[model samples]
Target: MKHEKRWAIVSLASIPLVMTLGNSMLIPVLPTIEKKLNISSFQVSMIITLYSIVAIILIPIAGYLSDRIGRKKVIIPSLLIAGMGGIVSGWAAWKMDNPYILILIGRVLQGVGAAGAAPVVMPLVGDMFKSEKEVSKELGVIETSNTFGKVLSPILGSLLAGLVWFLPFFAIPIFCAISILLMLFLVKSPKMKKPVPFKKFFKTIKKIFKKNAKWLIAIFIIGCILMFVLFGVLFYLSTMLEDEHKIEGVKKGLILAIPLASLCIASFVTGKKIEENKVLMKWLTFIGILLSAGSVFAISFTENIYFLISIFFICGMGIGVALPCLDALITEGIEKEERGTITSIYSSMRFIGVASGPPLFVLLMKASHQVMYYTVTGICILAAIIALVGIKPKEIK
Candidate 1:
């Protein structure tokens, strides 16, 4: 990549990196918050869940607005709003006797801001480069940054919270501020000519779906399923490590990051190789999910952490390869004019997965290990079947 292109990717990539830091970083700190506020586990979870619930509702709206006005026009303001949300949550946690409801409100605002920012990135990247290979490469880096954030979130969250229980909350705006500065200065979005008229935009979307709904729906469902299993397993691992294995803080974070690091490496590699090969992308994704299912099945047979870690690492690679393939498939298949809206819907479904994963995992964990792995493996198999049937290599172009 040229200096300009590298700068643009760097700036655009910061959005997801920062947004993830704001959310996933909280996971390790949730127990601390529960203790600090004397809140229940369910209530502490609300602090995380409410953010995704709000994002799910507003992302498509932001997508439409980005298409109408311009990507930067929407993104900058959204970043500022998200930063403000961090300030609100931080202040509440810092000052209030019971910051529970206030923190939830702040997270809700953060979700609103997230709707406009990170979800817009796929469309923005699609608009940036002309070469299919270049888009795939950049998106690979972007996805790597996201998974890298996950790798870091637990350790960072635990570290910050160890110093001050609310430190993680205050850190959100700082992360956003840095990303905003990079975006404002370095990123240059494509100029929008005459946008589709408001009167006809929805009709255009309806028409696009009419023509492409099969693949679109498949992509959406599989994306949701991937995240659902990813987060759910991560949750289960985090708790199992902390509660069962008598691990805590950075030690647990490091152990948790093992699988995620595999995920990051796999996403980067797949993104590079799957460039514009619709057949390769389709089959890689199909095989990745199947591999993930098989790995989950392996975990069903193991009670050992060391063995489970290795198994989870394989599962991470499976999810890693599938994610960017799904992203590329969607971005490449769609028209640029409607990319933001369609991709936003994709992002929303992803958040839906993140939102539902923890609670769903909580419910499933009451069952035996066989039941848990069986259920997750079933979702993975279903995702594989969706790719096999719904995603055609011919449709990728």
Candidate 2:
């Protein structure tokens, strides 16, 4: 990559890193918030859920706008909005006697902003690079940035919250502000052709979907499953560490980072290795899901913290290996004109997984730990089957 493109990639990569920190950083802090607000576990999970649900509803709209306008046009204002949302949540948490409802509202605003920011980066990366090889590599960097944020989130969040319970809430805006500045100063949008009319754009998207439904749906499902399992496992681990093991604060956060660190390294390596190879992408995705499923399945038999952390670390590696492949496939396979919309829809499906994961895990775990593990493992198997059967790379063109 050229020097300018390298900086652009850095700018683009910040969106995911900041966005992941804004969200996942809150995971380790959830139990803290739960106790602070005197709320139920389910209600606390809703903080994550509500943010994602709002994003899920709005992401497609953001994608359509980005397709018609430009990526930066959508992204900058979204960052501003996200930062404002953070301020709202932080203020409410710090001052209000009854802050839960207000905090949820603020998360909804953050969700609105997130709808336009991070999801748009995939297509923007696709827009920025001409070479499929470069695109795959940069997308890997983006995924690595995302997972790295996850690795940092627990420790950072815990560290911040260690000072004050609501400190993590305030930290969101600082992260967003840094990303916005990076985007403004370092990134430039590629020139786009004449915008397609709404009716024609709709028809074109329909046609693309009709033609690529099998693989598209498979990718969509697999993306959703991966997030569902990832977030579900994180929540499980977060609560388990606090309730079962009497761990909290920075210690808990450090423990949480172990699995995510493996994920970060795997994503970085896989992103570099796949390099425009659709066959490799497909097989890696398949194998990654199996690895995740196998590790999750093992959780049913063990309660040892070391064993559990080790299992989650393996699971994180599996997810890390698979995510960039999914990203590259969707970004590379789609036509540039419609890539934003298609990839945004993919992001929305992943958000659906995020929205559902924690509460569903909470419910299932209430029934039985075996039931929760088995259910997630079963979903992973189904995703693997779909990837094997539905994604015919030879037929993508």
Candidate 3:
């Protein structure tokens, strides 16, 4: 039974790797898609934004359904839909040669499927692990898989794009397929000794929120701001590489992969430390925002590509250190029964930042490089203020 439970955690952890790969894997391929389709910068940016839009719309619904039906039931279908979407996008990229519409449609599908997989995985982890310590440890493993996918996807996606621009789209389906199999074979839903009544369940949810609404909202906003700052920088850097530096395809992939590598390393280290101390987590998050804000500032000061890349890497490390702690904080704050709904809300706020980041950053870039830094910097300051004011350490557990 113990082995079964551990295997279940490992299996569920794979869901994020499969779903997020479709999102991050496409980053390196973005420049290729632009060339293939001859789309404008705004249109190229739309592919990413559209994916987030779909997720933002669907995540709460998926989370609600997971609560109603069961996590496994919703998750399996979500993977299948996302995989089909990937295959369709690849075919469209190949046949129509109009990368824009095909990729957009594919991304929408990926988002819908991805919506169910990512938001639910955390709640599932909550349901499985009984102890705070165990939950923290598993959250670390889960967070690692999530960041690892981000790290590896760009490298692999870039390599695939080298062979064929459309390959990354098709490649995601294979991962989804594997995840589906593992989920079905190895993952099992825990038997609930007693289920909550609908009225009581709603009352319980309200009570939890009533107790911690302020902190919950603060953490959600902080996560959103962090995502906003992180992705905004990434979008700006990707464009700078292709437009200013004249880097494309595999070279673009290599440059982008540098910061993601930092993100992967930092996520693993921070997850452990955060489990031990919320005060430390709070300080680390503040520092992460500082590092990220500094990176955006650094980009404005330098025309040197190496320095620009270094700043982006520093920002990614800040995000990496901050993300798991955010997850751990939310998990620690909520009761087990409410985990699905609360995590869903948390995921939605993060997607809101993601969905908005690119277009907002791109728009700011038109004004000046300094504008981009200031915008992200302002967001970080807001997040920092919330952390300082709203998150009381004693209340986390």
Candidate 4:
């Protein structure tokens, strides 16, 4: 890559890093918030869910706008809105006697901003690169940045919440500001063709879907399943560490980071290795999800914390390898004019997974630990089947 493109990647990478931190950092803090506000587990889980739910509704619209306008035009303003949402949450947490509802509203605003920011990165990366290999490699970098944010979130979140329970909320704006500055100074938006009329755009999108519906829908479903399992497991682990093991604060956070670190490393490595190979992308995705399913199934038989942590690390690696493959498949397969919309729809599906995970996990855990593990394992198996059966590499382009 050229130096300019490298810098642009850096700027583009920051969006997912900041966006992930804004959301995932709050996972470790949920227990703290639960205690502080005297709320139930379900209510605290809503903090994550509400942000994702709002994002799900608005992401397609953002994608469409980015396609018609420009990626940077959509992203910078979204960052501002996300930062403002952080301020609202932080102020309510710091000042209000009853901050729960206000905090949720703030999350809603952040979701609206997120709809435009991170999901746009994949398509923007596609826009920036002409080579299929370059697109695959950079998408890996973007995915790695996302997972790195996950790895860092628990530790950073714990450290911040240790200082003040609401400190993490305040940190969102600072993160967003850094991303915005980087984007403004470093990233150049690719020149786009004349904007198509809405009717023509719609027809084009429908045609693309009709031609590629099988693998496209399969990838969308797989993305949703992976996120659903990832967030659900994180929620389960966070609560388990605190409530059952008597672990809290940074120690708990470090423990939480172990699995995510595995994920981060695997994503970086996978991204580097799988350059433009659609067949490899399909197999890696299938094998990765199978690995996750096996690990999750093993969890049903063990309660030892070490064993559990080790299993999660394996599961993370499984998820790590698969994610960039999914990213590359979608980004590489789509035409530039429609890439934003297609990838955004894929993103919205992932957010559905994010939105559903914790609350759904809470209900499953209530039934039994075996039930929870078994259920996720079953879902993972289904996703693997979808990858193997639906994604025909020869058909992609």
Best by lDDT: 4
Model 2 vs. true fold: TM: 0.99
Candidate 3 on 1-397: residue-level lDDT in tens? 8899888878888888887788878776776777778887778888778988899889988876777778898899999989988998899888884556777888899999989888899888878877766777688778888878877777788889899888988998899989899899999876543557779878988888888888889889988887777666677777788889988777787788789889878888887666657787788877887777777766677769988888788989988888887888888778766777888989989988877788888899899878777777777877878887887778777
In model 2, which range of ten residues has the least summed lDDT? 388-397
* Local distance difference test scores for all models: 0.87, 0.94, 0.82, 0.96
The per-prediction CA RMSD against the true structure, in angstroms, equals 1.4, 0.8, 1.8, 0.7
What would the TM-score be for candidate 3 when compared with the true structure?
0.95
The alpha-carbon root-mean-square deviation between model 2 and the true structure, to one decimal in Å, is 0.8
**301-333: candidate 1 lDDT, tens digit per residue:** 766889989998999999999999999989888
Candidate 1 vs candidate 2: the lDDT winner is: 2
For residues 249-338, write the lDDT of model 2, one tens digit per residue.
999999999999999999999999999899999999999999999999999999899999999999999999999999999999999999
**Cα shift from native, residue 246, model 4 (Å):** 0.6
Clashing pairs for model 1 are none
